[model samples]
Target: MRLIKVDHIINFKLLGHGDDPLDTKKCHIDLNALRAREDAAIRRAEIEAERIGAGVTTEAQSIFDALSKTLPVRWESTVIVVLNEVRVSSPYKPENVVGGAGAANERVKKVLELERKRMQHGRQ
Candidate 1:
């Protein structure tokens, strides 16, 4: 039902009196086939994207798990691990680590200061 004009030329003609009905039917069939193919392609791309996302999440979790193991259980109460866990839930991904690393380091520095304050209060 949509009109597609190309360079001042109408590629398709409306079926009317004395016009060929078969040609119009053929165009409709071709358009439906093209749409079906496009939809299938879009679905495939979405599935692939989801698969990649799951792989990335799994890798990130592994890295965090290794980091956790490197430190003692008592250290889990530390600010660094808490902040890193927060970033794990963040929209930022490992691929963007180069740009995000600086900001993350800054946050760690701030968290370190807070930890120091908490320790001082605990001793009081």
Candidate 2:
């Protein structure tokens, strides 16, 4: 079995490298999207910090290797690194709401209509 080094990826999704129809490469590789996924990985690592010490592992990777490793899970809560930044979901009402999802131009609505017709044989 050989592992191919992939570089091209898009939208947090991996596209595959070979002509084979059943390729695991497509589903497994998400290198370009890792930055967006870093927050979740960090949060997961934080939660599992204790496991690093008492974990049962005979063949442990290097310190740097483990540090660079990303968690296979995602985080729900948004973790902000900058100070003086309030959370957007804070319902307590803030002094100012600037440059946020709510403040942005969000006008994406859906149009719905009925496809049914022929009401009682053309309303006879």
- Best model per TM-score: 1
Residue-wise lDDT of candidate 2 within 48-118, one digit each (tens)?
A: 66334233222222221222242121111421111123222111112222233442212100000010122
Whole-model lDDT, candidate 1?
0.44
Q: What is the lDDT of residue 15 in candidate 1?
A: 81
Query: What TM-score would each prediction reach against the true structure?
Result: 0.23, 0.16
Question: What would the per-residue lDDT of candidate 1 be over residues 46-121, giving only the tens digit for each residue?
Answer: 8554323232444334343443343321122211143333332322233222223566645543543454455458
Candidate 2, superposed: residue stretches over 4 Å from native: 1-32, 50-124
Q: Model 2 — TM-score against the truth? A: 0.16
| Model 1 misplacement above 4 A | 1-29, 54-124
